[model samples]
Target: MDTITTLIERNDDFVENRFPSGLKLVPTLKTLIIGCVDPRVDAAHILGVQLGDAAIIRNVGGRVTPAAIEELVMLRKVTQAGGGDMGAGWDLIVLHHTQCGITRLGAEPALLATYFGVDQQELAGKAINDPHEAVTVDVAALKASSSLAGGFLVSGMVYDVETGRTEVVVAPSLLREETTVG
Candidate 1:
């Protein structure tokens, strides 16, 4: 009845009855979603993505760090090399949520630095004053990456943890100025 044991039992049930057999490596939706590690913000549920629908990358604050870029590049390369119907291209969705824990770290610089193994100065780059602004910044970083090939659409979104709703902070077209998500 411990947590791990319960989780293992659930996994057994999943594999027995719910697991999708013979699914390919390529996601059915041909998309990638980068989101926060916050338990309240489940990217799959928020985006309505079923299993094998999209590749999800979760991290603290969901910042587009160097490691995230590397993973994205690898995903692109591998999927293209796989040579299938889903190999055409994939879109990117950067989802940040309101009331993220990173927004609170300003009051605990020491803890942040220790957790990330970096000095206080380095922690400034990870700050999240506003979820909307953070999503915009992360989307821009992903779009600017030369490693990610052209023709991929990137959208920035903010999920409201309180209301259980999500809104577009930056549309994929990137044609209009910022709009308040209401």
Candidate 2:
């Protein structure tokens, strides 16, 4: 009858209809894509990327953590030994969508810190008090710690769901702007 009820009913039907393919996912995905866990944002499908091409690491707001760092290192090793490189030939896309629920945490420092398992008041004292900045900074840190080759590049961007626009926040050389004035 209401919006919430309607949404719940629709989701129930959707899952029930799709249960035949329940978690029957492919293993050994190559690329490592750090993306938000937003239902509206399907990193693989939205990017026109295929399965077995990437290992999607999703979390609240798509924030990169120590685990993400470790995953990248492991992936880098595997790719290298197999005569591949995670940084160069492969892809690493950080999909942070605009109007994200994570941004709400930004305005609430204490709650954000609590959610992230960090000292609330203490972290707020740092220059990076904003939750968005906190997440993006950590993502960048993980990218730097990766053992991917010289060609490997790391970037950050926010996807606009309404307009289907993606804006680069932290641009690695790989996704640099190539301006060709017509």
Candidate 3:
């Protein structure tokens, strides 16, 4: 009846073909991937995670949202139920890509304002919504809001579509050594 249903039905064969063995499924996701809709970047493949191991939130530009944080909060609760829980605090990865249509769209202020229903002047004053900055900012906000143990690890990265390489963008900090050298 809906586009999702239609698409799933049409592709059911493809999905069934992939899961022919009918493996058991479990929810062990302790990580969250916020990535763009670029077809070249597959979050699951890049993160080397199985189907039931991670919760991925993908948007036009992989921007964080209220909904994303809500999902994290719920997941954290589930993972904290017992010792050796697999779903506790989440590792957040904000993956952006080079030569991204979303980035291009982000660079254009007028277009950004037009889509967000605000004017350039308002946007410049932080009154208007910016889709690009919103994504990065949201990830940070989510990290701050999450109350999970170990204080929710958050990192932002840029993926080069051509080379299939990803690099982290770490801000200046006094503590915690950088994990990935960009």
| Candidate achieving the largest lDDT | 1
lDDT of 2 at 12: 99
What would the per-residue lDDT of candidate 2 be over residues 1-182, giving only the tens digit for each residue?
Answer: 99999999998997787444533123244356788788987787777665455678887777665555666667666655766545544456676776677755557887666655568766553224243454467555554543434444566677778987676777654522222211
TM-scores of the models, in the given order?
Answer: 0.82, 0.59, 0.58
Q: Mind giving the per-residue lDDT tens digits that candidate 3 earns over 8-88?
A: 987897677765354323246556677877788778777677776766777666655455556555655554453333222
Ranking by TM-score: 1, 2, 3
lDDT of 1 by residue, 49-73 (tens): 9898999999888767777888786
Q: Candidate 1's error at 32, in angstroms?
A: 0.2
Residue 25 lDDT (model 2): 26
* True-structure Cα RMSD, model 3: 7.5
Report how far off residue 59 is in candidate 1 (Å): 0.3
Q: What is the number of backbone collisions in each predicted candidate, taken in the order shown?
A: 0, 2, 0
Residue pairs with backbone overlap in model 3:
none
Question: Which pairs of residues clash in candidate 2, taking residues 3 or more apart in a chain or in different chains?
Answer: 87-152, 88-152
Whole-model Cα lDDT per candidate?
0.77, 0.61, 0.57
